[model samples]
Target: MKTIIKYMLLCLLAVNTVTAQQNSQSINLSNAEVTPYEIELTQNKTTHILFPSSIEYVDLGSSEIIANKVEATSNVLRLKTVKEDISPTNFTVITNDGKYFSFNVSYKGQPIQLSYDLTKFEKQKSKKQSEVLFKDLGSISPSLVDLLMKAIIKKNKKELNIKSKTYGVEAWLKSIYIQDGKLYFHISISNKSNLPYEVDYISFKIKDRRTTKRTTIQEVSLKPIRSYITSQKINSHSKQDTVFMLDQFTLSDKQVLSIEVNEKTGVRSQVLKLRSSEILKLRRVELLKL
Candidate 1:
């Protein structure tokens, strides 16, 4: 009887092992295979690939092909062939948005296409899956941050009445959102007159809210890690919305946040102030809902 019991246990274990092996082969293993994009390069000409987000890491399968990020652009990768008609090799690229791309490289005297945009081909993960971050972005994924900004722009809800208007131009504070350990501010600029309103700059600063004017003012400037602006100039009778991402910060009761926008070569400067109470009224972003 003891021998029969042992034999039965062995049989069950064998069956389970066989099932697990089949499941892995049919599902996970098969899904792990990714098709590589095919491209050809030449010795003289260079190929440029534009990504939707910033490029983080790149790996060359062979030394025959050299890749570099284009100057003044974070997401553009320039590829060139080291030897004429070199053997077929491959390369890999990782974007800041947590997307992986593979390419099969070959040599061509004159490739059909020299420029490629991989924006639409990128696969966006769920909010939970998109928690990956880069060094510049801190704790939040840059791609996720961009998505949140798009959602806020789509909603287009004016959450606060903070704004500045002059010379038939206005800048409105639309909404404030917080996620991970960062803050997002949505702003809108409108040109209501017939002339275009060219923007010189927009700045955010924390200043002392003193009762009397002091000879030496205390102010701390805050810079956004990422900013999206539609246009530098607001066309007549049109509005442009922008979003800025900053590191999370808090202020004392005696300090206030100031946002200023200036016109290029013009005197249409506007300033909007927010107290600690107003800054604390930020809404937490729900990435799933977005």
Candidate 2:
């Protein structure tokens, strides 16, 4: 009985040792050591890899291998080896903020590993994204309101002054201005009704008002350059000043231009109307550097 118990303990210890070895297959590079950043995966097998941040782009060796982007707290990369001859191939990954990484995908059925090279990934500035207004909203100058007022006064143009109040929020189209082939809308929003109101999104477009509810209306594309509402949320009884930039467009008598604002929560929304008369009365302003 004593001999049997000793043999069983030895067997259990061997199994545990194998399990630990299998789980610790990852290669780490924290100690400034130069090691190969490679992984050996079997053909037709899928492997998941976790990264330090969100990934934006990935380049596989070929289209045959499938690479999927997994959105998580941190970025996850899913890679599969479909073809047999695709072993020993190289791949690259680029994070949304421009962090770069490379790896070798093999079919030798080796264990999983990681490679971290401080010399290669020294943490550089992330590249700017294409979301123009959302990214630049926080950096909007405090003097923007004064500049807009000065421009309106200098031009001496009649203000559209189109305003609306809905769901405890009041919005006004102070004026319209054009600079460098771009149209700018100066807008003011006040939360006077004491209800918590926040701007979710703002959109500018031209539509045929005569169309029926089910009719399809043509939309005009306008990109935003600088906007205040796009950047922050307004609380109850507070005021917000903002501007929108878009391609230069001339409104026709048959079509109407509209700016729609939706609240972050609840059913509160507001629309500012602009017809040919108001759009045609736009003032020309000097282009200020952002």
Candidate 3:
């Protein structure tokens, strides 16, 4: 009887050794390193997680569902999963990440959970600033010819001249210079009207007439000038204006550039054309060199 008992004990030890080896192999297979952002699906549900580098999916069958829910608390991302429901045939869980995971109601008995890591698909940082670039045209100024193109469709030259002579708009060449290895511009506008008016839109157009090709860097939209009366007794006129600033530009020699501003629904606009020499002159003036 003692011999039989000893034999039974030896048999149990052998069984335990085999079970331990199988468990170790299973762990090594499931935890293989995978590429970032790559996904692995098992049983039509995301049972194992892997990145782009992962070679295979690890399956955790229904019996192992209880132990399948795991959390990753790495600095890259914090993840959590919980079992929502469990049945004899299947199991379900919900995962929380940047967004909540969705669940289906149709699979009431065989619900599946999904989770993902986004660190692999993160966008790289950009060095460029958010800006718009206009074309490069040599020194150009607002000409009466260009202004006529922006005039109200039906307004005649007589009416326009009368308006300009009576309530003429003030004009000025603000300045031009270079900054951050690029050119910069600032243009200001003022409203000298007695009545309040609304400006709908503004546009800038550049006409490049240069012997060499020039690269235009940036353009800015200016707000329309609006003004209204503050009081009746004073009967004082109020004025409002807009200012535009351009940056990062390179101009070629002998370029003639035209910058035009137009107001939407208003029969008026301001245009500026400057040549390379004129731009240099303005820069010098700004620097107080001449």
Q: Model 1, 213-282: lDDT tens per residue?
A: 6457789999987887767888899999998888899989999999999889988878989888889878
Best-to-worst ranking by TM-score: 1, 2, 3
How many residue pairs clash in all the candidates, one count each? 0, 0, 18
Give the Cα lDDT of each candidate: 0.84, 0.65, 0.35
lDDT per residue, candidate 2, 122-179, as tens digits?
Answer: 3452322121112322433323433554555344343777988876788888878875
Model 2 / residue 290 / CA error / Å: 13
Which parts of model 2 have CA positions greater than 4 angstroms off?
1-158, 213-215, 229-231, 287-290
lDDT of 3 at 280: 58
**Model 3, span 1-290: residue lDDT tens:** 99999999999999999999899787664454322222222333434332222111122234524223234521222122234343323222222111112211222233354554433432332221111122221232222112221221112111111011123333234544442333434443445656443444334444446433467644333321111112212111543323333434444564545555455555555566666656554332123221
Alpha carbon lDDT at 253, candidate 3: 63
Candidate 2: the clashing residue pairs are none
The TM-score of candidate 3 is: 0.30
Worst 10 residues of 2 by lDDT: 127-136
Looking at model 1, residue 71 earns an lDDT score of 92
Give the top-scoring candidate (TM-score): 1
